[model samples]
Target: MTRYKIGVVGCGFFGSSLARELAAHPRFELAMLCDRDFERAKDVAAEFSATPTDDHDAVAADPELALVVVATPNHAHAEPAIAALEHGKAVFVEKPLAVELVDAQNMIASADASGSPLMVGHIMRMMPGVRRLADLLASGELGEVAAIETSRSRWIDTDGADPQWWKLDKSRTGGELTHEIHELDLMCWLGGEVTAVSSIATADDGFRNTVVSFAGGAIGRHTISTRSHTSSWELTVDAAEGSVHADFHTGRVSRLRGGRVEESWPIFDVDAENQSLIDSASRTQKYNSGNGGSSLWMQAAIRHEIDEMAAVLDGKADSGSPLTYARERALVVAEQVRLGGGEPAALSGSAK
Candidate 1:
C-alpha cells in the first residue's frame, strides 16, 4: 500500500480526532500537526508521534507532506486549504467548503490550477445509514425523491459562553446554515442540484430555516435551531414510493412504506449504533460539546471519507468535486441575505 504523509491544520476537536484516526490508518503517516495554539498541537502530535508546529505555512511548504487536511474553524478553512492546494498537495477541507463563496471558489480554483486533488469533508455522505439511504434511493426502492426535510437542533447556551467561542459568531460559522451544512449538502446530494431557494428565516433565539427547490423537482426544508429544548439530528426523504429516515442521534436508518417500517438498519456497526443510542438517551446536544470529539459513527464516517480521498489520489474516480458542494452552499447563503433584507447583489463579495 502506498502511504500518504498527512499534515493537519487546526489541532482542535475535529483536527485532533482526525489526526488520531489517520495515525491508525495503515495507508496514512501522520507527518505534522499545526495550530495557532502550539501546546494543543504538541499534545495531539505527541499522541501520534507526529511533528508539531504553530506555523500553518510550514505544513503547506513541507516537501515531505503529501496531503494537507484543513480542519480549521468554519471561516478559517480557506487560507490553509488554498495554501496546501497551491503547494500541490492533495487537500481535504472540513466542510462548508468555506464560510464565504469567494473563498470557496478561490480554493477550488487553486486546486484546478495546481492539479491537486481537492475533496470536501462531508462525512454525512459516508455514514453507513446515510450510505444505505443513498443506495435505496439510487436503486429506485424509495422511488424518486420528492422532498427532503432535515433538522439539527440543540440548545446553545450563550449566556456564559467564552467570547472566543467561534461558533457564537455568525460571521465565522455562517450561522447554522453553513455551520450545520451537512443536512443541506445531503439534501442536495439526494435531491439533486439546488434550483432555487425560496425562503430563509432566522430568529433572535438562534432558529434558522431555509426552503430550497432542487433541479430534480424536489423541495427541501433545512432547519437548525440552537434554542430548542430538545436536541435532534435527522433527515427524512419523502419519495414517490416511500420514505426513508435517518436518525443520527440513534444511529439508525429506516425505510418505510404505507406508514410502516419496511426495513431498518444501523447507521454503523452494531456496537457503534448501540453506543449512539445509549449516548443519545443522556445527551443534551446532537453535536460535539466544547472540546469533545464527535460520536462513534461520525468518527467511522471520517475514516470512510479518508479512504475515499485515498482512492481519489490513487487515480480512481471521485464522488464529486468539492466545488459542487460549495456552490450549493453559496446559493443558500445568497438566499439568506436576500430574505434577511440584505441586497442579493452583496453575495458577490458579501462574505469576504
Candidate 2:
C-alpha cells in the first residue's frame, strides 16, 4: 500500500494526539508539523519523526503532503484549511468547522472549488455504540425513532484554567457550536435532517440548550452545560417499539424492546472490521478522544481518511462529501442559537 504524506497544523492536545496516531500508521507518512508555538510544534514533530515549522505556508506548500489535519483552536480553522486546499491538499478539520457561519461557508466553497476531499471531526457518528444505534434505527429494529435526547455537561473551574482561554470566547469557539454540535450532527444522522429549531442559550451561566425538529417528524432536545458538577455524555432514542441508549463515555449500548432489554459493549472483531473502522473513524474524526478498547481502531480511521484522500488523489475513491453536509447542518444549528430571539427560521432541507 502506498503511504500518504500528512501535515498537521496546531500542536494542541487533539492535534498532538492525532499526529502521534498518524505517525504510527504505516499507511501514512507524517510529513510536517506546524504551529505558531515553535517549541510545541517541534515536540510533536519529534514524536512523528517529522519536520516542525512555525510557518503555515511551508506546510501548505509541501508537495509531498497530500493531506493536512487542521486541529487548531476554534477561531483558526479557516485560513490554514483554505491555504492547504489551494495548495492541493485534502483536509480534515476539527469541529464546528469554523466559529462563524461565513467562515464555514468559505471553507465549504473552497473545498468545492478545489475538488479535494474535506471532512470535519464530528466523532459521535463514529462511536461504536452510536453506530450500532444508528444501524438498529435503520433496520427498523427500534420500530421507528420517535425522538432523540442528548445531554453533555461538565464542570468548569475558571481558577484552574489558563489565562489564554479560548472556549469562553463566544466569537471564537461558538460555545455550543464547539461543544454540542456533535449531538446535533448525530441527531441528524440518526433521525433525519433538522427542519427548524427553537433554542434558549445562557451565556452568563455557561449553558446552552436547544430543541430541534427533524424532517422525519422526530424531535431532538440537547442540553450542554459547563456548570455541572460532573461531565456526562448521553444519547437516547425513543421509538414505537422500544428505546436505545448510548453512553458516549463508556461506549455502551442498551436496548429495550417488547418488554425485553439487551445490552452490549464494543468489542474487537475481525469480522466486523470494516464497520469497526467506520465507527472508529467517526469517533476520532469528531471527538479526537482515544478509543476505549484499542487505540488501533481509532488510528485505523485516521489512516482511512488519509488513505481515502490518497485514493482521491489517485482517482480510486469517491470524495466523502457527507461530512460537508454535516458541517452545514452544524452551522445551521449554531446560527439558530446565535439568532437567540423568537422561533428559529425554517432550516434549508426538508425534514421528511
Candidate 3:
C-alpha cells in the first residue's frame, strides 16, 4: 500500500483532529503540521511524530509532502489550498470553499491548471445514511426527488473551542452562510445543479433560510442556525413515490412510501447512538447535543475520501469528484448570503 505524505495547515480543532486521524491511518504519513501558533503545531505534531512549523510556506515547499489538507478557518482556506496545488500536491480543504467567489474560483482554477486531484470536503455526502439516501434516489425507489428541506442548529459558546466572535463575525468569516454552503452543496448533490437561489440571512440574530431552484425545476429549502442552546439537524426529502428523512448527526435515515414505512437505516453501524448535523470544532467535531461527537462514521467517510483521492492521484478512475462542484454552487450561496437577499441581481455569482 502506498502511504501518502500529508501536511495539514491550521492546528485548530478540525485540523488537529484530521492530523491525528491521518497519522493513525495506514495509508497516510503525517508529514507536517503548520499553524501560526508554532507551539500548538508542535504539540499536535508531537502526538503524530510529524514536523511542526508556524510557516505554511514550509509545508508547500516540502518535497516529501504529497498531500495538503487545509482545515483552516472558513475565510482562510484559499491560500494554503491554492498554494499546495500550485506546488504539485494533491489538496483537500474543508468546506465553504472560500469566503469570496473570486478566491474560490482561483482555487478551482489552480487545481485545473495543476492537474492535481482536487475535491471539496463536502463530508456529509459521504455519510453512510446520506450514501444510502443517494442510493435510494439513484435506484428510483424514492421516485423523482421534488423537494428537499434541511434544518440545523448548534448552540455556540464564547468560551467554546471556537469563540463566538469568530463564528458570528460577518466581516471575518462570511457570517452564517459559511455553514449553509455545506447544506447548499447537498442540495445540488441530491436535487441537482442550483440554477438560482433566493436566500436571506440575519447575522445579528443568527438565522438563514433559502429557497433554491434547481436546474430541472426541483426545489430545495434549507435553514442554518448557529444560535440557541438546543442543537439539532434533520433533512427530509420528498419525492413523487416516497420521502426520506435523514438525521445528519445521529445517522438515522428512514424512508416512507405510500403512507407506509418502507425502509430505514442508521448512518453509522449502530443505532445505539444519535448524531447531529452540526460538526463543530468547539466540541472537537462532536455532536454531544446528539451523538457523542461527529460520530466515528464521519471519520470513516474522511478516510474513504482520502483513499479514493490517493487512488485517483495514482492513475485510478474517480467519479463524482466535486472538486469545483460544491465550491461553485457555494459561491452562489455565499453571494446571496452576504447580500442579505438584497436584490435578484445580487443572486448573480459576482460578490460585492
* lDDT value, residue 114 of candidate 1: 93
Output candidate 1 Cα RMSD: 3.8
Candidate 3 per-residue lDDT over residues 241-347, each given as its tens digit? 99988876555688988767778887755333223323332252222221132345556767666655666666664455434344456566557656654323322
Cα lDDT tens digits, model 2, 7-41, are: 99988877877787778767778889999999988
- Ten-residue stretch with the least lDDT total in model 2: 283-292
| Candidate 1 structure quality by residue, lDDT tens digits, 100-201 | 766877777787789887778877787666777887888987778888998888786556566777876878887666777777787766776555665544
Best by lDDT: 1
Ranking by TM-score: 1, 3, 2
Q: Pick the candidate with the highest TM-score.
A: 1
Between prediction 2 and prediction 3, the one with superior TM-score is: 3
Clashing pairs in 1: none
Per-residue error at 106 for model 1, in Å?
1.1
Ranking by lDDT: 1, 3, 2
